[model samples]
Target: MYELKTKENDRSVVEFIENVESPTKREDAYKLLDIFTETTGYQAKMWGPSIIGFGSYHYKYPTGHEGDAPLVGFSPRKAKISLYFATGDTKREELLENFGKHTTGKACVYINKLADVDVAVLKRLIEQSVRFLQDTYPNNNTN
Candidate 1:
């Protein structure tokens, strides 16, 4: 069986944010916290050591691998802030087209700062991710 490293934990979200080394990144973390919370209507939780996550869902792969993951989350990393969103959603790419300056990987979008991107588009991405995961894993309780 494979283990997921990014499981949710009881760590304090505020404490994690406060410990962020960069003052700018720390400020951005708080801003993102507010955005994800208001948009998803779910309280933030600490995922792993670094990520601030909102709602969650359980997923099982065809290979019988399964795990719980956050519907949306972000980490203020050393280089850039990584935004976790749903993969395989065509609308995600469509929204990214108008999402201001950002880069995308298989599962995350990277931005230098919140000021570099449109907050409205970020909210849409968060909402779409939550909706996609909810629809894909309907039985998984969120929040």
Candidate 2:
């Protein structure tokens, strides 16, 4: 089980964004971080080394393998941005259609830039993903 940290050092996350070499990327990351914070209403957090996470949730499956995972999060990678959608693959195709040009793994959505996507749709997707995860697992760990 992944131990969930109640508090995070927001400064570290901001510092990581500030240190990005590309000026444009850095500025845009800050802007999106603002949007993410406003949209999710969950304080931003640094998950692991790079992922800037929003709220968090706890999961336990039939096998008893469970852990604390962020409700929604994203990372500004060198090649592209990665959004974590902790939900199923049922609505994956539908969301991709309107989410603009992007790629997807089992649960991660990749976008080259914010300019290529709709902020509203992205926010909705994150909101939906968080809700789904919350509903799927009654024992949510947001503290």
Candidate 3:
């Protein structure tokens, strides 16, 4: 059985943000916290040691692998901020076209700062991610 390392925990999100070494990253973490919260309409929770996540969903793959994951989340990392959104959404690729400056990986979109991206587009990405996960995993508790 494979274990999920990013499981949600009881750690304080505010305390995590305040402890961010970079003042700029700390400020950006706060900004992202507000954006994810208002957009998802779900309170933020700490995922693992670094990710500030909103909402959650339980997923079981056809291969019998199952785990819970956040609907959306972000981490203020050393090099760039990582934005976690649902993968396999075509709409996500389309939205990234107008999302200002950012780089995408399989599950994370990296950005230098919130100022470098359009906040409105970021909100839409968050909403789309939540909707995609809820629709894809209908029985999962995504809220």
| Candidate number achieving the greatest TM-score relative to the actual structure | 1
How does each model score on lDDT? Answer: 0.92, 0.78, 0.92
Please give, for residues 25-81, the per-residue lDDT of candidate 3 as tens digits: 999999999889889899999999999989999988898899999989999999999
Pick the lDDT winner: 1
Candidate 3 TM-score, C-alpha based: 0.97
Model 3 Cα shift for residue 100 (angstroms): 0.9
What is the TM-score ranking, best to worst? 1, 3, 2
Supply candidate 2's per-residue lDDT for 45. 87
Looking at model 3, residue 136 earns an lDDT score of: 91
Q: Residue-wise lDDT of candidate 2 within 52-134, one digit each (tens)? A: 88888777779976677788888888888888886574665677689998998877898888898988888778777777787
- Give candidate 3's error at residue 69 in angstroms: 0.1
| Model 2 stretches with alpha carbons more than 4 Å out | 1-11
- When 1 and 2 are scored with lDDT, the better candidate is 1
After aligning candidate 1 to the native by TM-score, how far in Å is the CA of 17 from where it should be?
0.6
Q: Which stretches of candidate 3 lie over 4 Å from their true place?
A: none
